[model samples]
Target: MFGKTINEISLNDTAYFEKTLTQSDVFLYAGISGDNNPAHINEVYAKESIFKERVVHGLLTAGLISAVLGTQLPGPGTVYLSQDLKFLKPVRFNDTIKAEVIVVEIDYDKNRIRLNTICTNQNKEIVLTGTALVMPPRKRMDI
Candidate 1:
């Protein structure tokens, strides 16, 4: 009821959201995911590690994509089917992340859509890329 219906949505429609990750954000995500990996939570250990500093959880950044899909692109009432993600770079605390999604294909008959997803850091470096499959809202007339 919140997003564009299948008939109203078109190919190339896009949406994006940005967030600056904080140490608190990393800690909260780590606690929720139970990923107490030293590289993410312990500065000393991280400094000793190859990254030289705590690296934010990859999935934590990826979650931004889900936020875009749920609140913007296909919007509410959309059902996420599947997603394939590739991690291209590491995200550090305080990195501003931009999560974007573009509609690539729409199957009106099946009421499904395929989209390209991407997340970039402040420097416009690709941190993640992927494709998502989702069932978009049904057309009001058809329903």
Candidate 2:
């Protein structure tokens, strides 16, 4: 009786978020998170590394997943409980990423949703995959 009402949730509910990765995005993330890894910030070092080019911070890309959860699907009132992520590919500057989430399971009693999350580049290559556990709002509010 305390979480999202059973009637308000359903399987297969989906949400999406998109952004074009930029140099500023990487730099700002580094400044804010204090993760100035060379592979993400140094052109010379990155060119020598396996990727052979600068790569975006993994967590910055993952933040798109958070945007989807916080702004869509279960939306504004949902409480993020946990997540499991697997990075499949590198994200580079200028790559347009589309992040998506689909509801796969609903716990009626607990008012929780288990969502399958994924992010793909403009080329449709999967770059990130994960599952998120969240608690939706207890009651609907009129907009």
lDDT top scorer: 1
Model 1 superposed RMSD (Cα) = 2.7
Worst 10 residues of 2 by lDDT: 1-10
Tell me the deviation in Å of residue 142 in model 1.
Answer: 18
RMSD of each: 2.7, 2.9
- Tens-digit per-residue lDDT, 18-130, candidate 2: 99999999999999999989999999999999999999999999999998887776777778999899999999999999999999999888878899999999999999999
- Model 2 TM: 0.93
Candidate 1's TM-score reads 0.93
Flag regions of model 1 displaced more than 4 Å: 139-143
Q: What is the C-alpha lDDT of each candidate?
A: 0.90, 0.89
Give Cα distance to truth, residue 3, candidate 2, Å: 12
Clashes of each: 0, 1
